[model samples]
Target: MGKFDDLPETRRKGLEKMEEVYGFDMSDGEGDFFRYTADHLFADIWNRPGLSNRDRRLFLIGMLVGQRANDVLGIQVPAALKNGELDEDALRELVILACHYDGWPNGSRMNAVVEDAIGKAKRAAGS
Candidate 1:
């Protein structure tokens, strides 16, 4: 059997959820960080029923901006766009609102990241 065949149910669900959330395959991830990320973050946290994926993405975007987590935003912004969690206009508006609350420096950085992600997505889609 392959490595994933015997994974605990949570881990398997996490892997599936991670792919859905990130718009990419997550089956090859390794190490403890990857395990916890897939198992706990994705499976338990993201899959929680109260919030829709788009709602979660909006909250996460604000949190990332507040924390000035540009690198993670690079990953998340594109994934949000790709997964239809947020469109380019909505992302731009989100940055505007986030900037007011999180400050311009972080918002500025996030704005650039969001624009870049949108550009890349548009190009990839041949739009």
Candidate 2:
């Protein structure tokens, strides 16, 4: 069986969700990093039973903010909207909450990334 074939149902779903969010493609021959991300990070970690997808998304947002991972958030914020994990208002609240923990500079950086992501999503949506 292939690696994909060996995936648990939840892991397969997690991989699908990851692709929807990040446009993550395994067929691009990107490298080991992408493979590991798809197989291990999304499959193994994200698929872990206990947390719902919504709970995972919330945790992701917090970790991204704490890490100042604005580039990752560029994809995540839009995904949150598309996946119905977060609406615009919830996104705004996330920024506000992030500011309290991450401070102004990082928060502003996150805001900029969110704005850029929102613009990208809007254009994709024909607005």
Candidate 3:
């Protein structure tokens, strides 16, 4: 059976949505981990109890910042915007916070990905 054969339609769509935000597309042929991460990361881990989606996005952004994962943080900027948990201001704050912990090198280009996100947001908001 395919890795995603057992997933619900909504769950599959969530992964597809996130993948699109991440500049990826999916296929049953992708790989077990890819399918699994899509289901778990977007549909499971992101949908679990307690926190709102925005709250979760914030935490995720902060986690990337703390770990010096500027690249992931950059991609996440658009994802967070899609999830409605962030705006340019919030993303900038996350990068600023990272500078104190992870240093400026990573924090610097953080805006590159984030800028893309901001531009997308502006486009989406019709600014």
Give model 3's clash tally.
0
Per-candidate TM-score against the hidden true structure:
0.89, 0.75, 0.66
RMSD of each: 2.3, 3.9, 4.7
Give lDDT: candidate 3, residue 110.
75
**What count of clashes does model 2 give?**
0
- Measured with C-alpha atoms, the lDDT of residue 94 in candidate 1 is 88
Q: Write the per-residue lDDT of candidate 3 for residues 22-126, one digit (tens) a residue.
A: 545565435777767766676677667898766766777777766768667767778777666676787778778777777788777676778788887789789
Candidate 1 regions off by >4 Å? Answer: 1-6
Between which residue pairs do clashes occur in model 3? none
Arranged by lDDT with the best first, the candidates are 1, 2, 3
Better candidate by lDDT, 1 or 2 = 1
- Over the stretch 1-127, how does candidate 1's per-residue lDDT look in tens digits? 6455678888888988888899987774789998889889998999999999889988888888888889998988999999988888899998898889888888889899999998898799995
Q: TM-score for candidate 3, please give it.
A: 0.66
* Location of the lowest summed lDDT over 10 successive residues in candidate 2: 21-30
